[model samples]
Target: MSPAHVLEPTYDTLRRRLLMGAWPAGQRLEAARLAADLGVSITPVRDSLNRLTGERLIVSQPGDGFHVPRLDEAGLRGLLDWHHAIVTMALGRERAGRPDEFQLTGGDLPERSAHLFASLVARARDEELDWAIENAAARLGRFRHHEAAVLAEADKDVGAIERMMDEADSPGLRAAIDYHHDRRRSAVDQLIAASRGGQII
Candidate 1:
């Protein structure tokens, strides 16, 4: 295979591992070790690491190599803010032809919802914005992997947002956006606390 073709899957696999919280926050990642684990040479692993660094999913420190970023509340807020703006714009544009209520299931609700929002944002016809939304979603790491109650609550919140969009209630949409962020922040806070209470990563 071509170099690009060979490296693309490796990049994707590494991205999935990060998003799934395979590595602990702030865990150092040695390319040589990863290359050995993935049964590949260091070259592809290095290329994949470079791509992840570009996405802000992996941070490279001078003389220290790459590491998964430590979870940060401030960074989370910034990402939520970015998500809010892009989603609001996309919803506004889709208001004229809003579809039926979002049909969300329970298991994997967070990942599914992220995909749904990413799809909605894609309707904005801006590739850069779409990619940004996806990146932000993936960078969420284990924060969204909550209990059943949290997942159910998130499903409900998305339904409310969908209803607001269908009703063309701009104010309601804005409110829903705030509600979503607030709920997500609360969930993350709880998860952080629980993690500190002996739940590793």
Candidate 2:
């Protein structure tokens, strides 16, 4: 197979695994081992790691190869704040219509919440904003599984956001967004501990 063919799948698989927390934070990603496990050559794994590093899904050091980013409280707060800003900006824009295709009621809480945010962001009709939200989401995805463990009524909170979106209540939606992010912001320590102790989802 061509390098392009090998590279795309390798990149996609690694990206999925990384976002899903397949490896713990701060663990070194060995390209050779990953290549062997994925049944690809080391070159493609290295290339994929480099691409992921650029996307901020993976981190690289001069002599340390690549490793999963260990998010400190400050780092995690920065990401949450950044994502909240993007989503809030999208909400402030006047969209032509809702994303009718996104089913907010049909998945696990995290998946549904993701769709809800995607639908909200899609309304902005700005590619750059979409890209920014996606990048933020990917970086934060691994920590999402910890939310349920730390946050009370997590599902209800997401449900309220969904309902606000469905009802076209912009003010309510914005408030819900603030509450959602602020609640998480306040519980950063619990969230970090939960993520560290919990099994990889």
Candidate 3:
């Protein structure tokens, strides 16, 4: 709606479109056109895009307008490394000896692992998710650009990413991190191959 929220409906709309790969990387986006496309005025769109730019999901050239931020292998690895460190520090056995070690809370990951992951994936398709605990996964554009790559390359170890979050072995967790990368690389590779052939995976 209006620009009051500055980052809600407008931001969400853009993030989802990006996650769906609706636009190619480096394609410039004009706020007015995007506003028209979203059926709203340019104000909200500008504000929303500003927020994404702050998150490094969009880039603003000196005079070339705004475009989706493209990620290289280095950028991808940086994000994955953050995931590994955060997950390990927050839930690692060495740190707190596992959140599971403490018996409480109303969460049911062990019982509803598949359902939760599925829901997360669906939400991902519709919008962005923070993938952090305290934040409870708010929609943010940071991960959308990498979704296709993560999914395609990550197929071989989908189960393991879930396992790393659920299991508490230090070594296993470490392996799961690498496995996560291999899977994403696989997914990205497939997407790239398809792209080269003028198709999508």
Candidate 4:
């Protein structure tokens, strides 16, 4: 593994802290502060923040610094809806056709996984209306690191889930949905646990 692998875990740990209301919204991200806390360089922190920005978990302000986005009811619902819609659409048998093989072999991943995550992020960028609402309580300064971590896991599962997705006619879609949802729920719990450690809040 590369040296970067050691730092990758920081991204998820940081993102969750921001999401769980530890930092709140509209706060500045001090690179020096994070470096001191995480015992890493500033580069990783900056990279982590950029990743979070794509997720709409944090907003980047030109002069005001990085802010935890403000998410209202509609905004939160929109993200939740988008997540459900995309997962349903791509994995639903009715839409994507026959199921591909579900494979999670070791080694390099395919481009499809990157594409799906990018698409989810693109939906957020296309609109500012729902951007801040769902992530309102996030501590933007903290989660840049954690975002990277989540993306890594999500990246790994993306292709397998898409390939395994059942056609509407098949009985597999429901099971796939349940399987993916359970994984996501576990991730959420891990996020919450990491966030509430009182480092940011």
Best-fitting candidate, scored by lDDT: 2
Q: Per-candidate TM vs. native?
A: 0.79, 0.90, 0.61, 0.44
- Which lDDT tens digits does candidate 4 get at residues 114-138? 3333333333333432333234223
Stronger candidate by lDDT (1 vs 2):
2
Prediction-by-prediction clash tally: 0, 0, 7, 23
lDDT by residue (7-59, candidate 1, tens digit) is 98889899988876677677899999999998888999999998899989989
lDDT of 2 at 155: 81
In lDDT terms, how accurate is model 1?
0.70
How many residue pairs in model 4 have overlapping backbones? 23
**lDDT (0-100) at residue 140 of candidate 4?**
26
List model 2 lDDT by residue over 55-142, tens digit each: 9999999998899998889989999999999998887774666545546468566667667787788777889888988888888887
Tens-digit per-residue lDDT, 79-194, candidate 3: 55554444444433233322322222232222232233333233222232323421222222233234435364433354455545455445775586566544544454444333
TM-score quality measure for candidate 2: 0.90
Error in Å for residue 136 of model 1:
1.3
RMSD of 2: 2.7
| Candidate 4: stretches off by over 4 Å | 1-7, 19-21, 94-201
Q: Tell me which residue pairs clash in candidate 1.
A: none
**Candidate 1: where is the Cα deviation over 4 Å?**
93-107, 147-152, 159-174, 193-201
